[model samples]
Target: MIIHVDAHIAYRFEEPTDFLLQMEAAAIPEQALSGPGLTTSASEHEAHISGEDAIGTRAWLRCEGDFTADYRITADIDRHLVDLDALNQLPPHQLPGATVPYLFDSRYCPADRFQSFVEAEFGELSGGARINAMVQWVADNFSYVPGSSNATTTALDSFVERQGICRDYAHVVCTMARASAIPARFVSCYAPDVTPQDFHAVAEVFLADKTGEPGSGAWHLVDATRMATAGEIVKIGVGRDAADVSFLTSYGIAQMQDKRISVTRG
Candidate 1:
């Protein structure tokens, strides 16, 4: 499928400030599944009138690409050796307990909440099954709601709120999988097919299956935001958390007044 995407973010500062710096992960990186065709980004800054000055910052991005992916069945469950290289490539500075078992203290921790749901639905299922179930469960229960939530809401908050946009949903799934001892990462990118183009987030879970051929591990892409099954191919930017890959930032006192995006696919 050929997809086209446009995203825009704007911030207006209450008071003029000295500096601004932000890391943009809006440009999607070519990944295991998808090919990139054409992509571009641009930004504009404006200073307000003389009386009491305010800083205004605006950014716009447009991306076009073709995505082709093949679906694969879930791999058999078994213990497989971890691939150190692949593991190392992941975002650093994640919550410390990620690779070890300990009481997860972060207010954002989703392990306990996911565990409760796993027990209620599929008792005694192995970690792999629990992860899969969580993926399926999120897809089943939630529908995407643009502008419903932002970066701060927790998984429990999302569950109770019952309505969220992409980031919240992805956080819910990623947090749950990591809590279950699965090495899950958060991804941000453009989904050209989604209406009202904007940044999107998804979850990728690392799996090991001893039953599979030697030296092979499995990866699963779960799209809680769209309730869509992600295949191998898609534009992606990965990070331990949203802060690591936020598309836009301003150091000055800028506040976003309006933003818009548009997407189309064929």
Candidate 2:
């Protein structure tokens, strides 16, 4: 399906600082673009945008005063969500070398601490089923409070607090899935129908087994947030955690004035 996505954000800086913005879409196999997928601010400024990396395009801008970032995209998402039961989790050695590291802990997703809990709850299940159970458990237990969490709240903290935003949900599930021996990573996404429209957070679990053909594996999108289904969402970045996929990182103090994101079927 084709869709249009846009994000506009205004930030007030305390002084001159360097800004790293990441709220742009990348051209991926699943997303066919009409033009350049990510467009930065038009205002003349010293900005350097590196090519899209495994995570996403990161642009550095030096600004002394206030700044505004605007980005838009028009693309078609061509993919289908596979049933969890149909996928088989691959052992670490069988997974692509790049996918192997996500199975371990990150700053946000600390899988080691949850080993005992995961074993007690999901050790009996194998493959996608175990991952699905973890997703469902996260959705069922975590409360979606808009301002309930901060940058310091890790997966363990959210598991104990029982409340957080999409990032927290993704973090907890990533941790649980990793604990269950499934390779999972955080995805920065632009999802249609996101209430209070904003950049969204989701997770993908690498499945070694597909429905047909031998040695077929794929990354399966699993959004415990449940706002947009797995297939329809637009992917931006795939990282070990949110820190690796943050929308913006600034070297100086900056307070948000206003932020808005919108996505619509085209």
Candidate 3:
């Protein structure tokens, strides 16, 4: 599948502010990108940097007064879909260095706190089966309330409230997977099928490869909200939590003036 994305963001900066923006779809092995690239009103102060694990690109910018950014991209997704249940969960000792970090707690996803819950609720299951069940539980029990959560909401909060947007669902899934001794990370992405047509978030779990080799594993995407199909997601980047992959992170105060995002199938 191919996806076309166009986004325009405008903001009012109270003073000179330094910002890190990760909006463009990642140029990973699974997704190929062909486009002119990001444009901004304050191009002089903009520079590009690599995203976490080098999965995508981020922009560093300094601006005052008013700022606007325009980005458009065409992404050809070549990701192969597989059965999550068929994949094995490798032991923590066998995990690669990069995957080990995802097994612990993070700010928005406190895996430590959910250990008991996960054990009681999903103790009977293991590997991808447990992950599948966890995702289903989230889908069945939660309500998709757009403004039900805020920037500070965590997975524990969402679990208790049983309502939130995609980000919250992702946090819950990540937390649960980590609690189950499965490595999981948060993903920032774009999906054409998402209602309201905004940025999307999902969870990526590290599992043993099809061959079930001891130290060979791969990351598989999972969406608890069911808004993003496995093969259709165009990832922006990944991090331990949303804080590391925010579309816009300002070092100083900034207010949103206007923002519009459109993603469609091409």
Q: All candidates' lDDT scores?
A: 0.49, 0.81, 0.92
Error of 3 at 178 (Å): 0.4
Candidate 2, residues 7-122, lDDT tens digits: the string is 88988777777878888777678888675455544433555454334545777876766688777779788986678886787766666777778889999998999999999988
Each candidate's TM vs. the true structure? 0.60, 0.92, 0.98
Per-residue lDDT for 1-266 in model 1, tens only?
Answer: 34444444444445543322221222222222223422223223322121101111123322122111111111111223343223311222333333322223234446666766656675655445666667667778876777777658777788778777777777777777665556666666555545445656777676544444333445556676553335322333555555544555445445555556544443
| CA lDDT, candidate 3, residue 70 | 88
The residue-level lDDT of candidate 2 at 51 comes to 32
Candidate 3: segments with Cα more than 4 A from true spot: none
Clashes of each: 5, 0, 0
Model 3, residue 30: distance off in Å is: 0.4
Per-residue accuracy of model 3 over 5-69 as CA lDDT, tens digit each: 99889998988889998998887899999997688896338889999999999999998899998
Q: What is the lDDT of residue 101 in candidate 3?
A: 89
Error of 2 at 237 (Å): 0.9
- Higher-lDDT candidate of 2 and 3: 3
The runs of at least 3 residues in candidate 2 whose Cα sits more than 4 Å from the true structure, single-residue gaps closed, are 35-55, 211-216
TM-score: which candidate is best?
A: 3
Q: Which ten residues in a row have the lowest lDDT in candidate 2?
A: 43-52
